[model samples]
Target chain A: MDTWFYIADLAGVAVFAIAGTLLAFRKQMDGFGVIVLASVTAVGGGTTRDLILDVPVFWLHDATYFAVIAAAAGVTILWLRLKAYIPLNRLLLADALGIAFFTVLGTEKALNTGVSPVVAIILGTMTAVFGGMLRDVLARDIPMVLKSELYATTCIAGAIIYVALSSWSQTVAMLAAMTVTLVMRFGAIRYGWSLTVFKEHK
Target chain B: MDTWFYIADLAGVAVFAIAGTLLAFRKQMDGFGVIVLASVTAVGGGTTRDLILDVPVFWLHDATYFAVIAAAAGVTILWLRLKAYIPLNRLLLADALGIAFFTVLGTEKALNTGVSPVVAIILGTMTAVFGGMLRDVLARDIPMVLKSELYATTCIAGAIIYVALSSWSQTVAMLAAMTVTLVMRFGAIRYGWSLTVFKEHK
Candidate 1:
């Protein structure tokens, strides 16, 4: 079980790091900037969650996360010539999977720490969304979590579902929650679904 | 001593909240957006520091910080009518004071936790600058700490001074460090001191 969890975690890190590196590339950032963005996008959400939960920061204790981010970043830089061949949809799918995995993991961690259901759901959503938000902010773009599709909303809904089903088997609840989050996100990406924009009235 | 610290902390919160609210107003964000910006700008740095130190989030345990932020935001909203009369320099001064106070306070807290001096100084600088960085990011502006002025450098220098002088009386060290930070920041504001911008080569 622990091995599976670690594998999922590393996969998420790699996906987010690639996304961040691509963004930095798009923004014409230098090599150092690309690495910084990749590292932050890979670990920022979990770091925020751990801080809020008063736990040891995940990346600080485990060097594997950093190694994964560095490896992903290297792959991204080396694949610069193949950028035109890389499908956007595939990136989106990887991002959705990462969000789903992180949401369940964060919600379960919060629940284990004895926080209220509401806070757990919120933290879970934050944990799933904040990394992307940080990446966008660093890249000088508006955070997609704040404006695009049903990103954060999907995480929140999945977290609430996970909490509500806590009386059932933990593994079953986790799987169910991850499925819901991924489906919602993928649906949004496929269908161009989005939350309403709040334009200011003049 | 504790009372004085609380007083200074609240003052810093009020100043940063007001600055955040005014920025939100300029960005034409709604009331909820204004409050969110204000709250994050006031407490974001210290909250970040506490999280890194693995300590209980300060605002979670105490309601006063939120109350102070609310009051400051309210005042800023009401003072919008008198915007032209509000001197920008005074706001800068308040911001300078906030950086000084937070730098010393964060450094002391990190030292209390037995972190190495270098880590303490870095954490202290983070505590001093991250709130403003968050505020700018939320307002969709590049962070001042990253781009302009001697802001974060002042905090770093002050934190180093505090740590180096730790063998001396804590009170004297704190006061001296705060004074140095304030002087450097005020000098920057008055003389238009700034770090060199890193323009990307075409």
Candidate 2:
């Protein structure tokens, strides 16, 4: 269980790092800017969570986590330069999957640490969303969560399912959570669905 | 004492908000982007500190703090068209003073709350500089603290001095810490003195 969660964390960081650095490259930013953006996007959310949990920074102790982010950045930057506008659709899908994984992992971690269920859900949402928040803020773009898109809603759904199913084995709980998030997110994107039904007021 | 600290916290936040929003505007950021920068700049450092210390977020509870930051941004955006530069230098001086103030306040708060003096000093340094860190990161610039400019060093010096002088009256400790930071920062800016002295290897 621990190993699976660790793998999920690294995967999330790598995907986030790639996304941030890719954006920087698109903006024609220098190498240093690319690295900074990558670094923040990889660590910003968990760092926020760790700090709030008052846990010693997991990344500070685990050097490989940092290495993966740096490696992801380097690879993504090179890849971006090599390929022209490679359908950003792939990157968006990867980012969505990564967020879903981290969202479940975050709630599980928070609950394991004995935080209240409400706070656990909030933390899960933060874990899923804040790296992108840092990425968007740094890139000077509106955070994807704030857009009409239902990004945070996905995390919330995943968190609720995870909490409800946590009494089951860890693997089953994770599978249930991830399943909910992935289906909802992809379905929403494919169908252009939304919870809000407000018509155009203007 | 409590009243003065609250006022100082407000002042620190306002200064940070002004600086952050101005930078965002300089880049032609939209209204939401401006608010993002302002909020991050005002609360970013303390949020980082709390996360590291594992405390419940003070800002999440205290809406007034966020309100003040919004007000600052609103004023800056409105008045921006009128002034070529809105006393930015003077406002920066105020910001410097606020940094000094927050450093001492953070240290004292941590210390009184039973954190070790060393940890208190770390928190102090965080409070003093984390806002600027968020600002630079959002602006897509490497944090100035990690640069040749001796920003973090000055913060460290001020925190150390404040902790050492804690036995004295509050007025004296505050004055001494503020002077140390102001003098170091001002001298660095005026003389272009930097801490990045590289030794020449023979």
Candidate 3:
């Protein structure tokens, strides 16, 4: 189970790096900017979680995560000219998957850190969303989370499910939580679903 | 002294809002983007400081900060047409002053939160620099702090001086810290002084 979680983390890192490269490339950012985006996207979520927990940053403690992101950056650099050949939709799917995995990872980490359940839920949601927030801000897009959307809602739901199901096997809990997140998010994207809480003052 | 501090905070909020508007408006951001930038510039530093200290977010509890940023955003919306007459250099100076005050304020808050001195200094410097980081990332500029500039170093030096003299009267400590930060930053800008640590390895 631990091995599977580690693999999921590395996969998420790679996907996030790819997303960052795509954003930087779309913005015509230079090589340094590409690397910066990749690093920030890959490690940004974990770093926020660690800082909130007052722990040594996981990437700082373990060289492997940093190495993977750097290698991903190198790949983006080498493939820069051929980037147009890549499938944008596929990359978008990977980005969504990364967000889903991160929601679970962040929730579990917060629980382990002994943070209160409610704060843990908020932190989990933040952990899943903030990297993309940084990316959109850098890309000059209105941050996607602020729109009438179901982004953080998915993470929050997953966190709640995790807390409720922790009495089960850890693997079962993780699977159920992640399934809930992916289903909710993909459903929102597929059907043009949205939350319209803001009403006209008139 | 409390009144003066609040006045200074209001001044900082105004300067930061204009600066944020400049960056966002250059990208042709819509009203929502404008508001997000204004809110982030005004409250991001303190929110970050509270998160690091594991404190309830102050802005959420007190509506004053939120109101000030909102009012500043309204002013920015009206002033966008007059932007051509606005002096960018003067705005930059005002922005630097905002950063200086945030640094001291963050340091003092962290000390009160019972964090260690070293961590407090780092938090102080982050509070000083992160608004600009958000601004630049949203503006798609390579962050100013990543340059060889003395931006955060001013905050760092001032934080050390602040910690050294923190036992003195709070007003005296604040005045000394602000003086050091302002003078150091001004000298750096005037002489194009920069930290040696950022010299590239190539």
Which model scores highest in TM-score?
1
Question: Best-fitting candidate, measured by DockQ?
Answer: 1
As for lDDT, the candidate ahead, 1 or 2, is 1
Sorted by TM-score, highest first, which candidate order results?
1, 2, 3
DockQ by candidate, in order: 0.12, 0.07, 0.08
| TM-scores of all candidate predictions against the true structure | 0.61, 0.59, 0.58
Error of 3 at A3 (Å): 2.5
**Candidates ranked by lDDT:** 1, 2, 3
| Model 3 Cα lDDT, one tens digit per residue, B1-202 | 6677677766666667767765665555543446556666766676787886888665433446656776776776666654434455655686778888888888887888888999989998887788877767655677777763788889999888888788787778788988999888888777887768555687
Local distance difference test, per candidate? 0.80, 0.76, 0.73
- Model 1 stretches astray by more than 4 angstroms: A28-35, A51-54, A70-80, A87-90, A187-199, B1-39, B51-54, B59-129, B142-202
Candidate 1, which CAPRI tier?
A: incorrect
TM-score of chain A of 1: 0.90
Question: Model 2 chain A, poorest ten-residue lDDT window?
Answer: A193-202
Off by over 4 Å in 3: A74-83, A200-202, B1-43, B50-202
* Tens-digit per-residue lDDT, A1-202, candidate 2: 7887899888888988887787787677885999898888778878777666666777888899879988998888777778856566675777688788888878887787777676677678778878888788778875665442467778888988888888777788788888888887787677765653122221
| Chain B TM-score against the true chain B, each candidate | 0.90, 0.89, 0.88
Tens digit per residue, CA lDDT, model 1, B37-98: 67778989998998789788766546677778878888777667445244667667767888
